[model samples]
Structure formats: C-alpha cells, structure tokens
Target: MRRIIYDVAVSRDGFIAGSNGDVSIFPHTGDHVDAYNERLATYDTVIMGRHTYEFAYQYGLPAGAKAYPHMRHLIFSEGVQLPADAEVEAVRADFTTHISALKKEQGGDIYLCGGGMFAGLLATSKLIDVLRLKVAPVLCGVGTPLFANVSERIDLKCISSTLHESGVEYCEFNLQ
Candidate 1:
C-alpha cells in the first residue's frame, strides 16, 4: 500500500502559513533544496485543499494547464467547479473513501501539498503515514498551524533529521 506524506515547510511555531492563508514567510533556499525536490519527485500525486491552490494565485494556471505535468493533482472541495479544460479534477465530498481507493492504485507515495486543515483531517483520521517537514526559522504569531483543528494527540516516532547552516531542519517521522 502507498503512504500519504505531509511533506511541507513549517514555522517554528508549527504553522504551515501565516494568518489569512499567507504562505510567504517561509524561506526558499538552503542545502536542503535538493532533498526537497527529491521528495517531490518521489510522489506521483499531489494533494491540495481549495484554499491552498488559490494561495498560489500569482502563478495563474489557466484552463487545460497542467500545473505539474509529470504528476497527478488532486484538489478537494465540496462542489466547487474547475475550468472545463483544467487538467486537475475536484475531488468529491467522500474524500477519505476516495483517498483510500487512490492508495490502492499502482503508484508512488502521495504528497499532501498544503492546507493545515486538510492535513489535520488526515491526521485526525489516522490516515497519514508520514509527517515530513522542513522547519524554517520564522515565527508566525498567528497563522494556519500544521495539524490545525486536530484536538487529539497523534504520537510520532522520529525517523531521521538533518539540520542545515541556514537554520532549516529537515525531518521525517512515522506515525505511531
């Protein structure tokens, strides 16, 4: 079975993005850049919440545009419609069920691209297999926290960690 990895950049305070869905606070470069890209290349599918996709509005993707031509993109929303020609498909309300079916398909691991709320739901449901992160130095006092709305404790076992000169730490953990 394939695993779902929440491989994303995070703040010291555990936020995925700043308040109001601002994600510009995280640093972009470090020695970990290569490893980050490597992780991206490992997944054949990228998962994103509606808000997360909209956050990258600067890089406008018109209808029929393949955001990641090399990989499949899955956006979760209730009934929001995408452009008729958009390459991506909006997932149905039965997200968890559909996700399970995706996992059973022949493919590499899945990447949970963004949205703390979406990650929280996955974590809450005990569906996430890996919690992988790049910890940046910035501190967002108020922001969308990693694992937001997850009230219960989810234990994790650290698998490995690498600290870079830029003060960014690359870490991976397995759900316990």
Candidate 2:
C-alpha cells in the first residue's frame, strides 16, 4: 500500500504561508529547494484541498489545469467544475473512503499537498503516514498555520533531519 506524505514548507513559528498566502518569506533557491524538487519527482499523484488548488490562480494557473504536470492532480472540492478535457479532476467523493481506496492502488506514495484544514483532517483521521517539512528560518507573525482544526495531539517519530547552509532545516517524521 502506498503512504500519504504531507510534504511542504513551513515557517519556524509553524505557518505554511503568510496572511495573504504569501510564501515570499521562505527561501526560494539553494539546496533546500533543490531537495524539495527532487522529492516531488518521486510522487506520481498529488492531492489537495480546494483552497490550495485555487491558491495557484495568482500565478496564472488556469482553474482546471494541473499544477504539477508530471503528477496526477486530485483536487477535493464539492463545487469546482472543470472542463471535460482538463488534465486534473475535481474530487467530490467521501474523503476518508476515497482516500483509503487511493492508498490501496498500485503507485508511488501520494503527496498530500496543503491548506492547513485539509492536512488537519487527514492527520486526525490517522491517514497521513509521513511528514516531510522544510523549516525555513523566518517567522511569519500570522498566517495559515501548519495544521488547522486538528482535534488532538499527533505524535511523530523523527526519521531524519538536516540543517542546510541556507538556514532551512529539512525534517522527516513518521506519524505515530
């Protein structure tokens, strides 16, 4: 079975993005970014909430286009309508059931792309298996938190960690 990995960049204070969903505070270049890109290549499918999918619009991504052309896109939203021929599909199925089935499919590990609320739901449900975080040095005073609406504490067993020359810390953990 494939696992779901919540791989993302976060601020030292525990925010994924700033008040306006801005990630400018995070380092965009160097070994940290290179490592992130390399990890992305290992996943064949990317799942995310509607907000995270729509957040790409500011960068000229069309409503139904695939954010990562190399990966299959699964956007979980009840109201999003995409063109019939669009590369990505909008998922409106029961979250837990659909995701459970996805994990049983034959493929590379799934990438749990973000928007804190979605990550929180999966976390609380014990569906997220791993967390790969790129901890940037800066602190965003206020923003979308690392995980929102998590009902309880989720313990993590650190698998590995490294501090890059760019001051970004890369950490991997298994959900416990």
Separate clash counts for every candidate = 1, 0
How well does model 2 score by local distance difference test?
Answer: 0.92
RMSD of each: 1.4, 0.9
Writing each residue's lDDT as its tens digit, candidate 1 over 78-146 gives 855678878888896888888888888999999998788889888888889999999998999988889
Residues 35-118 of candidate 2 have per-residue lDDT tens digits of 999999999999999999988989899978999889999988887777888899778979877899999999998999997988
Which clashing pairs does model 1 show?
64-85
Which stretches in model 1 have alpha-carbon errors above 4 Å? none
Please give the lDDT score for candidate 1: 0.84
The estimated TM-scores of all candidates read 0.94, 0.97
Candidate 2 residue spans exceeding 4 A from truth: none
Q: Cα lDDT for residue 107, model 2? A: 98
Most accurate candidate by lDDT: 2
